[model samples]
Target: MSRLPLAALVAAFFVGLAWFVSARQALLLLVGVGLGSVLASTRFSFTTGWRRLILSRDPRSVIAQLTLLAAAAAISMPLLARFPTELNAALGPPSISLLVGAFVFGLTMQIADGCGSGTLYKAGLGVPLNMTILPLFALGSFIGSAQMDWWLALGNVNPIGLVQLYGPIEAFGITCLGLIVLALAALIWSGKKTPWFDRRLLIGAIALAVLMGLNLIIAGQPWGIVYGFGLWAAKIATASGFFNPSHNWFWSQPDNSQILSQFVLLDVTSITNIGVLAGALLVSAGKPPARAPRLTPTQWAAGLVAGFVMGYSSRLAFGCNVGAVFSGISTGSLHGWIWVPMAFCGTLIGVRLRRYLNFSG
Candidate 1:
């Protein structure tokens, strides 16, 4: 039927998938879908006639970000203030390690032409090179996790105690429902500054908020894409002779098992990313996936290497854009704001390079 309905159906399935799996996971994937949809909105190359369909400064992205932040704080504050456990979940603020890790991630996003969510969404669009890069990203994550103890030893900065705020807000299905509306209103209002608020913008915002809510209800956390795939790849690679014995052994524990035990910790999240690629392919099949003078083998190789850096750095930083920025902001973490500006700078530099290479505006 309609594109939005299809996305909703996919989201429904994603929620079920996460529910059957684990709440913790669904939460991360929801963040992925939410942000992916908003980013999807931003990718619209507005035309003169379709100005209304285009966005005003494409502000929905910021709206989604802000809506999430406000809703998260509104809910989270009460939860932290009343219940100690909920506060505990949201308190792992970034540290020196986080800053260092995030900056490196920024650099990698620039080189790879995709961050965590960006990579999965682009791959969803059937960018063949993205498929290649996904595995490299996983390998990097495995490396990072394997050495997580070392990072912690170096004062990775774990905020163990809760910085509690106010009351006890529900953390499941109902909460997801409440925030979805807020995200939508924020998006529509945010469009005021742009060229014009269009139907796609409105429809897309609601649909996306729905997607985010589903992920939260199902996964019990935010939606995250890149980290999972990259992690999956890392487990596979370390075991495949690409790395040392110890590297593969830990990840292999769950994955290597047969019957009643499998190690697809982020399986549903990966599928969520799969849905993004499918959505983009369906939308852009009428057009080429890449610009003219498409990337050469060397550039493709560079992209893959860069993707690896993102994987490693994102894991170290505790989240990528979707997790660190989207979910972090949604949870009202201060570092989330810090991350966006840093990432935007990276994007600007990348855009400049793209202009230099492709003469694109």
Candidate 2:
């Protein structure tokens, strides 16, 4: 696809969305494009950042991530505080499922080489492994959501909202302080040799933060990735009569049922997801195609399984790195805070698994 045609197609799609859907959805498509472009151009990957930190004691990517969290928290917390009714936070309960799920998600992401956002953007950039994982990820996400009630039943508590409990000012302060502590820990872990910052990653972080704020303002919710995947799977399953939303606890909710019946374009997350794909395609037009990793049959099987498990675990954990960690922490949800350490522990094991599988990027 040439850049000129790709750009034209994106414009046409935007116009069609505005005409057939709504203006808000159209704008969200643009935001998604910006997100995809930034992520692709900067190579800002959460999975890679953590992996780099673990294997080489590099703190640059990790530091950029912390900066992103701090910046997002700075923007999102205050807006959530003021518009409590209009906006929604990405809150998930502190539960046994959360702990187990986050850990498993972290582990699988390393083997699969992508989290939710990572998967999407990589797929957009035409990475073969991620493209293969995309459908499996959707399937696992649907299954996880279908079984959410059982997971919650195992053990959980009501979600804790720091903004609601401590006010936005205090919540933002806490968020920033925590990020600072993490940054310092990363720096210490990396020793004196590793650089503390990368200008490209810092710019990407700031861009993502601003776009996330725009997402909240227009969509009335923080940015998310997993739910959209699950929803896509649900739509297909229900249509094919392989699954019944009416029988599923998660999809049986009034709002969930409503969206299930509507066009996918009407869904905020879905439209943005489409936009992200389009944006990536647009950006990749003139650039050389990214080289796909070479994998043995066993390695390929391992990656596909990891992709499915990553999807399922993300739902169990309430979100992937993007939905659970990024959006979760930024919006003052306590589960986001809990998600980090457990996922990191999983990553510790995952990197070893990645080596054992002989998967290389």
Candidate 3:
């Protein structure tokens, strides 16, 4: 089938998956696949293609991140107010070790061309090295999760009543969200140095935001791209003998594919990742190979090593820049804030080193 038609089929699949996940109710599989395909195709075209929005420097990405973070924070205010218990965990706020881990994560992500979700997403674009990183992410994540209990002990903070940054620190949450939205709008309107305003980008952003928001509401867990993908791979490698199941990696349990889209099923948003890469290919299929984004020899080595480090940190931190930082911050989690800045600062330094290192496309 053509990518267009296949995409339509996938969109339906995701809608069905979301529905099924939400209600534990089954809808026609064909319907799921079809609607999912359309939605995925739309997002891939608009978000990944038209925007030409690279993660590190794209205005849209930053805007979207800030917007989502603010929204999540705003929504959390009332929720915390209503159900005081849901406000914040008693776990220690970013410990010295977490700060250290975050710094390492920042450096590593810079070395690797992309963060956790970035790896899988780029893999869909058919990068050869990303294929390897996917598995490594799984292995590392398993180790991280297994040792998470120990880290939690180090995370010693009595999470205060919903972070009210203003008049009442609790009020700070929603107020910040509004200010963020305003700021992003201003930035988007300011200039056209790079391609940011596009229908495709808008579509993808809306779709992603909606999916993320809804997931938070029902699952009490955020919508994570990289960790989920890594976990998906973990399931596959475990079955394929790539990993030793006897090690007791915790989440390496049975594939409750009925709930969230498991790795093997090629379900909804997972297919969206597939759709994103495919959509990019379809657009540039006849064009030259993206001019092979130039990189220095050191940058190249950094990319490879950074790739592994990012994978490992995704495991230790329980998510990637997108999943842990973006999604986490959007949901008003403090850890999210910590991770994003650290990773971004790493990017600035990484860019400076790009010409010196063996950076690759």
Cα deviation of 191 in candidate 1 (Å)?
Answer: 16
Q: List runs of model 2 lying over 4 Å from the truth.
A: none
Worst 10 residues of 3 by lDDT: 44-53
lDDT of each: 0.54, 0.93, 0.49
The window of 10 residues in a row where model 2 has the poorest summed lDDT is 274-283
Expressed as tens digits, the lDDT of each residue in 127-153 for candidate 2 is 999999999999999999999999999
Q: Estimate the lDDT of model 3.
A: 0.49
Best by lDDT: 2
Error of 3 at 320 (Å): 2.0
Model 1 weakest 10-residue run by lDDT: 45-54
Residues 173-268 of candidate 3 have per-residue lDDT tens digits of 454755466455546654557554555545555555555444444334444545445556656666788766445434434542332234344343
Better of 2 and 3 by lDDT: 2
Model 3, residue 98: C-alpha shift (Å):
2.7
**Best to worst by lDDT, what's the order?**
2, 1, 3
